[model samples]
Target chain A: MFVSGLGYIIGETFKGLYRNRWMCITSTGVVVVTLLMLGLFMLVNLNIDHITETVKEQVEIVVYIEDQAAQEAVNDLYKQLSEHRQVEEVTYVSSEEHMRRLQMQLGGMLEGYDSALDNPLLASYEIKTVVPESVVELAEEFETYPAVSTVFYGQGYVENLFAVTGVLQYVGMALMLGLAVTAIFLISHTIKLTVMMRRKEIVIMKYVGASNWFIRWPFLMEGLLMGLVGAVVPLVILYYLYQYSIEWVAGNNLYFLSLLPAEPVIRELAKYLIPLGTGLGIIGSTFSIGRFLRV
Target chain B: MVEADNVSMKYNRCKQYALEDVSFSISRGEFVFIVGSSGAGKSTLLKLIIREIKPTAGLMKVFGKDISRLPRRRLPSLRRSIGMVFQDFRLIDDRTVSENVAFALMVTGASRRDIRKKVPHVLGLVGLQEKAKERVCDLSGGEQQRVGLARALVNRPSIIMADEPTGNLDPGTALDIMNLLRSINLSGTTVLVATHNREIVDRFKKRVIYLDQGKLIGDEQKGIYTHVR
Candidate 1:
């Protein structure tokens, strides 16, 4: 009997959909488009994070040591820099190696300046910080070192990256929220139309003393079915777009855009989509039919 | 059994009384007819009995319980004790005849075993066993009325309030339905039928309550449809 009831409900839902074909189709289309736009923005945000992380990983703080600094003083500075919690790795570059690399880089400009052995470049300790905020603190701390002449970092550029990504995250969230609300509203109205067409049946059911739950189940199921169906196209679109993005980044040698692993994102999305679609469907149907079923 | 003591129902903030100071008692296994013309408060009295609408004054009781004070939540159980057959034969169009009859049992949480056993028996009682599987839409007006009767009797309520059960049927079909109701009342179910069918009233000669413009004009045992302005 339960199976028969379920089958009857499913059959009736399809019949209702067929009767309001234009409304159903239009609502589904709206859901798909909104989800697609939201998904695209998410992908873009993920890639941006990947690129920012790669950039942060490459940025290193170089602390130049004074020319007259003693060997022990330089060792003390290195220890202090390493003891700091923010430092990931510390590498020492002697003044001679620094001058050799400078000479190699400026080979054409410094061709005849060989006798000018005043290689003002100092023995530097390159420090990699774990987080962006630590870079400024580490730079300031290095300036207090007796062996360190000056401490400089690309703080301006890093701050700009942080600010831009923060704005993007907010914008992405607002856009997704707006689109979700609109999609739910449209789907609810569509289900309302379906309910209106069967108002006579509902009225009879109520008069016959059928409980509110019994009357609500079939319509809720109908909405859930529509939501599930509506989600399919957008999920497929999102999957292909993710795959294309991974491939494009990999092909372009954009190693920076690899923060979100493709497999995990896809897996997480699959887990989220089923429940999200079902919930949206149920909510839309319930909201639309709640007032009408009050009797 | 049903009892009403000075029951009055007013609507729209006491501007009009649908039923005013009406009082009557119906016993089990008795057949009574509430005879009234259009707008004579027949439906309001029925609704009050079923506890679908509450009375504005006085006390009403059904099955030895105060119906006027019954909570909205308890109305379902109260209604279950009284079978109501509407004039329009409110059978769901999409359901088969057997399903329509089973619905009454279904709402009261009757066991599936009971439904399977009893639905066919009630349909058989109403002489519609052959048309059990046919959709209600396929049945004629008279057949559909029979289906409604079958549904009402399936639960074996002590009282049946039929508001014009045969209003849409021809005289022949209507008589058949009346005979069916008489048989039901004979079998220990009190039947209260509200109709304006003077021919049925005069022919059957059952107890009748005559009403005019929401007022009870007369009550008689085995009465004829006699009323003067």
Candidate 2:
């Protein structure tokens, strides 16, 4: 009985779709536009997150050791840096290696120090941090350690990068929210037109003793279908567009403007688009039903 | 069964009461008539009994429940037990006779087997069994009214209210419709006909409630219409 009831309601919903052909199409079209914009912004937002992560990876800290530091101090400093949770990677530069690099940088100008018994240059440890912001505290803490001469981690650049990325994430979220809300109202208004056209049928249903839910099911189903269809179309469009754009960028060899892998991004977006579209559509129809379906 | 006690109503448009101090009770298995000229509060009184509109003063009851104060959600249950027929028939033009009859049962949550079983039985009672698949729009007025009757009778309701059921039919078709109502009444379901048809009222010789200027002027058994203008 329940099965038949659902079948009947579904059948009725389709009948209504056919009966109000233009209105259903118009509402579905509105959903398509809304979900498409949502997809576009979501893609942009994800890529921004990816690019910021890449930038964070490039940030590093350099700690110069004093020339008078003993070998035990150098070994101890290497162990301390490795044990810290935020230190992702560390490379040591001996005084001898520093002198060689200096020689390579300035041809034969550094050849005067080639046979010197005591080296004038300092040894250093290059530190890559897991979190970009940790470099500030790491630099301060390193300055307090004995045998550490100086620490420079480009503090100003790291802070500015983080701040800009934080704002972009927030702005992206706000834009998506605004568009979803606008789509809900637009879907609802169009469904309202559909409801108005069916007012007589609703009145007849009331007179014939139809339960409120029984009467409401068909409209709800219609709204759900509209939302699902609307969401799916944009995903298909976005899939092709995203694939083409990703390939276009790869073909141009523009590695600096790193785009996140397209497949996972599309898969991730599908999860949200379907539900978001349907939820908005249902909300719209519910309001329309409330406004027009007066008993 | 239905009862009214000092029921009065005045619509928003006028200070004059549509029905004033009207009191009556309709017993089970009785065929009753509410006779009045146009604007004599016939429709208003019917609307009050159906609880379609509330009476401004006093109480009304149907099936032993205080219907004037019945909550909106409970109204459908009340309405389900009573079948209503309008002068214009009110059948969906696009539906076939079987679909129209089934529509009533479908809304009440009847299974397809039950609807299929009951629709034909009710249509058979109205003598429209052969016209089950025919579209109501394609039928004659008499046939269309029969479809309306079949829709009303599908639920086998305890009471049937026809507000001028014959108002749109020719004399021959009107008489046929009256005969159907009479047969339905004979089967022990209460019937209430609101009409100014003096001929059928006299012929049926049933209990009659007469209204004039929003007041009950007479309640008689086996009575005919007698008020002039």
Candidate 3:
């Protein structure tokens, strides 16, 4: 009995789709466009997150040591910097190493300062905070140390980068949400039109004792099929697009511009997109057919 | 069997009742006609029997159960036990006659093999066996109503309520539908028809329930259409 009932529902769903093929195709196209925009925005947001994370990792606070500070004071400052809860990692750079780095930067001018006795650069501890936003606060704490001469973490650049990334995340999320609502609205209106066109047939069905579900199953299935196809099309398209973009970036040696790897992004998008698409479809069909079922 | 007692129905915010103090009971195997002028609430009474609308007051029962309070989930079973036909012939025009009939059985969760066997038999009963493959849009008015009848009878319901089943047909075609209904009634399936076709109603000389202005004015065995003043 269940098999035959299922057969009937499947048969009716196909018949409904075939009969209204043009409408189905138009609605499906709408879904495809909506999902494509949504997926694109999602990918952009994901890549932005990756880029910001990499940039944040490069932000380091350098606490310069006073040249006259005693060795024990320097050791105490280093211990304090390491024990701070917000600190992720700290590396000590000897004055000699600092001079060597300076020499590499100003090659010909640093030839006279190669000896440790003549090296004028102060030793420093490079501090990395667990969160980039706390870099300024951590830098201030280091500045209060007696052995620390000064602190620098490129404060202006780091703050501006964080602000921009925060705005990008919010805007991306809002746009995706708007697109999802629009997609649901479009599908719902299309389903409404189909339901209106079949009003008489539904009346007949009701009179002939078709249960609410018997009448509803076909429209629900139609919506589900549309949503599934819509999600799959964009996912396939985005996967290849992202792959090609990644390959192009690698081929051109654009090391500064980071694109997230293709596989994980596509997989994550698929995880959410498929269910969302299908859920929107079901909701649309359910709303459109609700009034007619009261019979 | 069907029964109604003091059943009244009023549309929202409206002072006038669509039906008032209507009382009737139909026994098994009865052929009854509800004859009245337009706006006399004939259709409303039929809709009440089908439980499409609940009576605003008093009690209504069908198949010995109070359907006025029947739960929504159980409505399908109640509706399945009673077949209904409409004035518009309410057939899905794009589908073939056989498909139209099979839809009735399909809704009841009948097997495909049962539908395959039952559809042709019902179509044959309505004398549309040869036209089973023809689309409803291609058929004449009488033929379409016959298809509607075939759909109604396909499920083998004990009661058939038709709201002006012949309303769209010419006099001759209408008479043919009435004759078909009468024959089905003779075979012991209870039939209730709501119509204003005075000529056939008088010619049939069957039990008639007459209504006027939302009130029952006359009911008699072998009654004429104009017996009520």
Q: After superposition, how far is residue B220 of candidate 1 from its true place, in Å?
A: 3.9
User: Each model's DockQ?
Assistant: 0.21, 0.41, 0.59
The TM-score, computed over Cα atoms with residue i paired to residue i, of candidate 2 is 0.79
Give the per-residue Cα lDDT of candidate 3 at B67: 88
Reference-based TM-score, model 1: 0.77
Q: Candidate 2, overall lDDT?
A: 0.85
Give interface RMSD, per candidate: 4.2, 2.2, 1.8
Q: Put the candidates in lDDT order, highest first.
A: 3, 2, 1
Give the Cα error of residue A243 in candidate 3, in Å: 2.1
Query: What are the runs in model 1 whose C-alpha is more than 4 Å off?
Result: A1-60, A85-120, A127-145, A183-237, A248-259, A270-272, A280-295, B10-15, B35-40, B68-75, B109-113, B166-179, B196-204, B210-218, B223-229
Best by TM-score: 3
Could you tell me how far off, in angstroms, the CA of residue B149 lies in candidate 1 after the best superposition? 2.6
Per-residue alpha-carbon lDDT of model 1 for A1-295, expressed as tens digits? 5323556467657766675677677766766675566556666666665676676677778898888999899889989888888889999998788877887887778676653467767789988888865777778878987889877677688667667766776786677678666766665666666667667666555555555665677778777877787777777888877888778988999774565777676666656555666677788778777766654
Q: Predictions ranked by DockQ, top down?
A: 3, 2, 1
Q: Kindly indicate the candidate among 1 and 3 with the higher lDDT.
A: 3
Q: What's the lDDT for residue A142 in model 2?
A: 83
lDDT of 2 by residue, B46-111 (tens): 788777789899889899888977887887787788888878888888779999889889888788
